[model samples]
Target: MRLSNRNKTPFYSFIYSLAGIILVLWLIAFILEINKFDVLGDKSWVLLFIPTVMLLFLYLSGRPIFEYDSDGEALNFRNCHILFLLSQNNAKDEFPKYKLIKYNVVNVLMFSTLYVYVSSKKSNVVILKYDLTFMTKKEIKDLKFSLNKVVKTNGETSKDDNTVID
Candidate 1:
């Protein structure tokens, strides 16, 4: 199975584009006036500054397009910012399904992260983090289902192989 947020790319792109337009308009207005209004006019700089800061924050923390594939023996995951131009935190991972031990999803404020625990050759467990902020509720549900299925299979296989009949 393969899952991705490519379908919503246009929507996210539009939002960022709109924010950019607003930031530009505010800059132009501020430069033209410099000092014009008489009410809250002295603090008009606030109007220009607030949106600029907000846009910056949104861009920095913007949602990334996420992709997951479980078609073969290995599980693949990839994440890259919707606006790839300024994308700095792109992440990708591929590991065998049998290595998957457990997974957890943490939601804080407006961000969600997926923590995958896998057994490594040298280490008992390795943790991998993936951003899930952009995934829809249904997508998240399906992802949880897939992870749970993998964990359950791992547990059952380990149990069966370790059992000794006398």
Candidate 2:
């Protein structure tokens, strides 16, 4: 199973573009004095904060593009921010299916993250994290089901390996 937000890229990009346009319009209005903001009077600077806050909120909620591949013998995960050139933040991980021990999904306000634990040769466990903020509810549910299936298979295999036959 492979899941990605490749199709929804346009929608997310439009939202980001809208925020930028709003900020630019506000800046132009403030600089040229096109219209007077009577409510803010002497503290007209507060109006600029609205667009800034909107940009931040949208970025926090929709910046990352997540991909998960559970094909073949390994699990592959990738998370790359939409504005990759600006932020230069990307995470990628691949590990054999048998090494997967457990996983966790944490949701906080407008953000979400997935933590995967894998058994290591030298260390007891290796943890990898992926961003899940922009994933839909159905995607999240499918992801949970995939991880659970892998963990159950791992447990069963471990049990079989530990059996002693006389």
List the lowest-lDDT window of 10 residues for candidate 1: 32-41
lDDT of 2 by residue, 1-166 (tens): 8999878878877877888899999887766553654555667786688898998787666446889999999999988776655456578789899999999999998689898999999999999888888898899999999999999999999999999999
* lDDT per residue as tens, model 1, 1-166: 7889988889888888888898888887777666564455577687688778878777656456889998889999888787767677777889999999999999888788899998999999999888888888899999999888889999999999999999
Q: Which candidate number has the best TM-score?
A: 2
Off by over 4 Å in 2: 33-39
> How far is 74's C-alpha from truth in model 2 (Å)?
0.7
lDDT of 2: 0.84
lDDT measured at residue 88 in model 1 versus the true structure, 0 to 100: 73
